[model samples]
Target chain A: MNIYEIEHNREIVHPNTRMADVIEADYRILPLLYRIGIELGFGEKSISEVCCESGINPNSFLLICNTYLLTDYSPSSELIGSANPSDLIKYLSSSHSYYLNECIRELEGLIDKVASDLPANQRDLITTFYKVYRKELENHFSYEEDIVFPYVRRVIEHKEENEKFTIGTFEKNHSNVDEKINDLKSIVMKYIHSTGNRFESMQLLSTLYILERDLMKHTFIEDHILIPMINLLEQSHDSQ
Target chain B: MTANNKRVLIITPSRIVAEGLITILTQAGGFTIERVISSISRENENLLHTIPADIIIADPSMFGFNILQTLKNRLSEFTTAPLVSLSTMPMSRTIAANFDEHISMFDTAPEIVKKLRNITIVDTSNSEESQDNNIGELTSREKEILVKVASGHSNKQIADQLNLSVHTVITHRKNITHKTGIKTIAGLTVYALLNNLITTPNENL
Candidate 1:
């Protein structure tokens, strides 16, 4: 797939465009997005059913559907916080952080489930590589919340003096993410067609099936969350 | 045969791909394999570090170019054994990704076998100039290294960049000069650049 290009533009894309606009622009990519939605248990079926099966909130599903019109699926909750400043900032500090933490927790577990399933011999290595992924995602998200998010809220609400430094740091973090994505791509490739079999090849394939699904969900969160947050940060800076 | 008889360790990311290659590789019977590692590990990190394989058949299509890094990290350990990554598409992205390493990429299984045959048989005794024009020309591995050297990278930088030894880089450079009769790194580099081998500064093989 052309996932490399999409991932490369991880921090790119207009901040204010509704998800609908982004998805429409990438109509060809929609089928893949739909498959991911179904894979993530957000099938074309009713949001209620998907939520029940996957245990996700319906509002979030709607939000993702709203986003998929222009973007891939949904704006990250972090983006929701950044959409407004005063109330969202304080709430983000306490509640939104918890929500995000929960998402990360589930994502990590899903990744493990997927990795444990890969065969000792297979073409791809991406089954359940949560350790490397979680470590990076955790660090990245925490940095955004503790450092960048706070700066974003402050700049949007109060025009803090030190925001440029914070924004600069957020932008620079993209390079590291690029490197991480490459690593993930490596793991994915190990799965795609890179496996060298020993004994438990079938077991590995089972693990891969699950892990691949988990990764799709995982990327949805980041692409939806980080991309919008970066845009908000940029806009917040531009306004100041 | 079985795992007990597996002598060569084939590291890849896919079981299907590994099996297909093993089936094809064994069709001729010149070499026998022992194990196939489908994961990316320190043990299978690169061709350079993995237990020496009689032949390595890689599939980097799904992984983008990380397979090339393994190859780049591998090329310097030795230059003789065959490390071939077969892709549905030829001229592997790994070649583009790990431009400084020694790994060959092919589009089809037959091409991969042809390359292995050439390596094992050493059949090019009389056709010296024919090496450059035919499939043997540039060797995906050399092309990778040449792309880097051509782009103004120092031997040390090339070594570190490709995970090859400085001695190996120098040796390759010397060999390239000798084979091409270019006489100098600058000339060799100019020749490489002119040939569209490398462009950007960080274009790793």
Candidate 2:
């Protein structure tokens, strides 16, 4: 089953949930586990045990996993309060590297392989569109890393307040990176005539779809979890 | 030129004009001059078919005042490069209208670059719109159901409100999903808000 279908039927990962069982529920969570510095050799270890061993806050780990895996899972203020901002940031930043270095690079390779079988103009168009999309993804990640994350970190750690720069500014300027992926998918679906390399084309399209869904979940965590936690920090700093 | 630079094909009769434009484009820094040919002739017509270009800058004199027809005859069936007019002298609106963009001789380097960049943006967006069109438009009934569905109404509720059976409502919803390629209710709602089928309270104000 795909992640969405799994999400519909799967239970939320909790402190007692086995690391192996979580992957069995939805293998997509394996990447999330790796990003948060969790490794294999679960050996019947539960989520909390594995998180403690990795030095990751269990609450933060569970929050990220549930928010990612469960469609109905919304991070309440209480839930957000239970998690550590530093842990969340580490996970998110790791996610950025994972997306840029691994996911996007893999996509480029697959697109090249798929495009090799297409006509010259179509090949150029496909590769060109992918290149543009990759650049956009890079810009999005860099903005988060350079501007947003540092500001959030300062607010959480030093209680620093800057009126000119806030999470609100980031929220306003946070362009939807997934929409362009959707556009690329539609373009490929409509234009590409992969008669000989049908399997490769499907592979490329599926990877694009997975990336789009993964990005949506990534943005969800940012908007729902990260932003609220930072907002609370900003508010507390103001009162102090 | 870097691999990501916009590939621009220059087709002007004056060598001096092409060189000047090329220098300005190089300074502009996101454009690669793909080719520079004096004019389109019988011998060089096939070059247009073979050369990969993101944008085309051609003098109207090269096409004998018939830009669209000449380009159609020369370019391959798949070529969709936005034709830009490199105006050396005063040209009539009718002749200028044939080109996607017009660049005058008196234009500064930045102005020329801006026009070229704008062409690329327009070209990309136009292709996106065409791709969107390939999904096909919803029928009037499908649109009606889509608005209601986006408003967070269930199929039974929609059926009751629209004076139709729930089965019919479900069918319409399926058609909407099939046409738009958006499966989830949330995705459809966002699509509706984007397309302005349903407006939020903030937008109502």
Candidate 3:
């Protein structure tokens, strides 16, 4: 967390540690290294050598690589180009499961529970908004999982072709799910008067907050870590 | 709430402890002592919500009130501010885990200020990149300009404040941005937060 201490130690990357050793220590970072275009079976070479070969800032690269060890999420742009996309892919996939399976499902039920107490017109409007948002979220996740992730995998697998597709395409399509969720939060917090069921309102607000925060973290990992790594790959491919 | 000045809310039962902190903080300058509440009672509980603080330093056991419970109850309001638990005993593990920090009362005033400065930086901002702690090497003039820039002042405003030409202000900003690789005001704001050039904004509430 302290960047000065990290830089002054003269230990940006462990000079002698092999890629295999790094993966062995924490398999979670495996995709992170891969996103940086480092081959998984990287011939026992040190990270410094790989960073040098790839033209990445070693200090910034290692900071992102070590982020898996942090218990709490803190956003940092330093890891942008140096992240391993596959590592991000792995982390992001699980997050997708949590959102689609748990968060959306739970929110749908809560929205229904709260809507039951409202006027028919008001209930219909609120439910319609929730439905539209849920669909949008589902579609966003599907695009990443189906199209973007497959493209990234092909690049990682070294099957990249001279195609117009790039991470920039994904970035352009990326939706801020958090903003929609915030709209939902404002609707509930400010507009929806409590119908003597304070408990339902509180639960709805709390759920929205968790979804908002979690989605923000998820998008950050994509925008900051995954996309940046993919862009690095695209640049290298261009020079080829 | 003072719009520009950073406020600190100290919750302690002891009058002497509260006054001693008020004196030290006032001498530090630039800090406005929001209030020193003797207990986390109904009257004081209202203050926690009314007066937004950059930092809240409290003794959880001073009045036998669970300060953490009070914080947890209104977690959203206090999310951006750093919460420090000052006590003699080994801080409860939960306090260490939950609060932004834990410091002993015996710690020096400078140490407390340092902790406050560190935690005030908005970690959520993508500008968490450190300047490698290079704020030390900045000239006093550059530091002054950098502080102004970080606090959302325009170059023209900074020039007028420091009695410098806009061109000179721009040059200092370029040097700072080049040295730090942070050209945006938000990034510089975080840099200022780290170096204690400005206090955490009180409008987070």
What i-RMS does every model get? 20.7, 25.2, 18.8
The interface RMSD value for candidate 2 stands at 25.2
lDDT of 3 by residue, A1-240 (tens): 110111111222354677677777767665455445566546867877776676655544565555443322333444455455665676577668777887788888888888888766556656766676678788889988999998999888778897687888887777567756765675676556659667888899899877775576567667656776778787877788
Q: Candidate 2's residue-wise lDDT over A126-148, tens digit each?
A: 67656766787898899899999
lDDT value, candidate 1, whole model:
0.45
DockQ of 3: 0.02
Docking class of 1: incorrect
Report the candidate with higher lDDT, 1 versus 3. Answer: 3
lDDT, candidate 2, at A82: 88
Which portions of model 2 show Cα errors greater than 4 Å?
A1-11, B1-205
Query: Can you give the lDDT of residue B70 in candidate 2?
Result: 51
Lowest summed lDDT across 10 adjacent residues in model 3 chain A is found at A1-10
Docking class of 3: incorrect
lDDT (10s digit) by residue, model 1, range B1-205: 5432324445555556566777776874555665665544221232233354545555455343543564544453333344555454556443644332223333365765566665554345543332323222455656777777666678899879877777656556544543453433444443453355654323221
| lDDT of each candidate versus the true structure | 0.45, 0.72, 0.63
- Candidate with better TM-score, 1 vs 3: 3
Q: Which pairs clash in model 2?
A: none
RMSD values for the candidates in order, in angstroms, are: 18.4, 26.2, 19.8
